[model samples]
Structure formats: structure tokens, C-alpha cells
Target: MPKLKTRKAAKKRYKTIGGKRFIRRKAFKGHLLEKKSPKQKKNLAKPVIVSKQDTKAIRIMLVC
Candidate 1:
């Protein structure tokens, strides 16, 4: 049997919390802020949980 290697790219993008929930940065926060509203920019600053369907695949990538 062999151990699985952690995907560095995934490691940098996703974070595991309490071994159940996965947290990640919200998209569309970079650049082009001049046209975006204050509320939209504010919301993008927060981290969000990964979607249910995607969590399964993300978990595999985060495996230790």
C-alpha cells in the first residue's frame, strides 16, 4: 500500500475545518473594482464554504 500525496494547489486553495467543512475564498474579488458596487466588493472579502457536490472531490484532494 502507498500513501496519497497532498495536492499542493488544492492545499493552497481549500481549507478543512473540524474535518467536516471546507472553507474557501470567494471569487471575483480581484481587479475591476471601479465598476463594482461597495456591497459586492464587501461580500467578496469573506470566505465561503464549498458547495455540497464539490465537497466530495475537494475532500479527496485534501487527504492526508
Candidate 2:
């Protein structure tokens, strides 16, 4: 069997923590920051874990 290749984009955007959970950067904080409120911007700064529904797909993409 051929080895599975990790999705480069997913590998770059997502990270594994403690070899169990996947962490990713919050969205909507990359551009047009002037329009978003201070609180909203601050909240977006934190990283979030992948949802249960999406975790499976992400894990496949990451080859984990």
C-alpha cells in the first residue's frame, strides 16, 4: 500500500495538542479589523479546538 500524504494546508493551519486534540486559529480576524469591535477582535485571538463533527475529517486530512 502507498503511504498517505498529509494535506499541507491543513497541516499548516491546524495543530495537535497532547497528541489528542486538534487546535486551529479563530476565523474572521485576518482582515478588516477596523470594522470589528475591540471585544470581538480580542475574542478572535484565541485558538479553538475543532468541533466533533469536523474533527474526523480534519484528522484524516492531517493523517493522524
Candidate 3:
């Protein structure tokens, strides 16, 4: 059988603490910071868990 390859792009974008769950950075944090409030910016700084619906696909891409 051929070796399964991990998707490099998915590797860079997500991190799994353990098991199948993946942590990813929140969006809207990259730009337009000036207009964003302090609290909102702070909240956006944290990473969030990927939803259950998306977890399956990500697991396949990550080859977990």
C-alpha cells in the first residue's frame, strides 16, 4: 500500500492538542484592527476549536 500524505496547507493552519480535535486561529484578526474594539480584538486573538461537522474532513487531511 502507498503511504498516506498529510496536506501541508492543513498542517500549517491547524494544530491538534491530542486525539482528533483541531485548534485554529479565529478570523477577522488579520486586518481592519483600527475600527475593531479592544474587547473584540482580544477575543479574536484566541484560537478556537473546529466545529464537529468540519472535524471529520480535517482529520482526513491531517491523516490522523
Candidate 4:
């Protein structure tokens, strides 16, 4: 059987916890921060857990 390759882009975007699940950065914080409130920016910095519906596909990309 051929080896299943890991998707490099996905590798960079998602992080795993104990090889069981994934966490990812929240969107909308990438740019244009001046208009956003300090509290909103602070909350955006925190990582969010991948939704169960999306976890299956991400796991495949992660090859976890």
C-alpha cells in the first residue's frame, strides 16, 4: 500500500491535543485590527476546538 501523505497546509493550521483532537485559530483576526475592540481581539487570540462535524475531515488531513 502507498503511504498516506500529510497535508502540509493543514499541518500548519491545526494543532492536536494528545493525538485525539484538533484546535485551530479563530478567523477574522488576521488583519484590520484597528477597528476591533481590545476585548474582542483578546478573545480572538485564544484557540478554538474543532467542531465534531469538521473533526473527521481534519483528522484525515492531519493523518492523526
Instruction: State the weakest 10-residue window (summed lDDT) of model 4.
Output: 14-23
Which of the numbered candidates is closest to the native, going by highest lDDT? 3
Q: After superposition, how far is residue 20 of candidate 3 from its true place, in Å?
A: 2.2
The models' CA-based lDDT, in order, is 0.90, 0.92, 0.94, 0.92
lDDT of 1 by residue, 16-45 (tens): 888888999998988989999999999999
Instruction: Tell me how far the alpha carbon of residue 22 in candidate 4 is from the true structure, in angstroms, after superposition.
Output: 0.6
* Candidate 4 colliding pairs: none
Our tally of clashes for model 1 stands at 0
Q: Which residue ranges in model 3 land beyond 4 Å of their true spot? A: none
Candidate with better TM-score, 3 vs 4:
4
Q: Candidate 2 at residue 31, lDDT? A: 97
State candidate 3's TM-score: 0.88
- The residue ranges of model 4 lying beyond 4 angstroms of the native Cα positions read none
Can you rank all candidates by lDDT, best first? 3, 4, 2, 1
lDDT, residue 9, candidate 4: 100
For every candidate, C-alpha RMSD to the true structure in Å: 1.3, 1.0, 1.2, 1.0
Two-way lDDT contest, 1 vs 4, winner: 4
Ranking by TM-score: 4, 2, 3, 1
Candidate 3 RMSD to the real structure = 1.2
Better of 2 and 3 by lDDT: 3
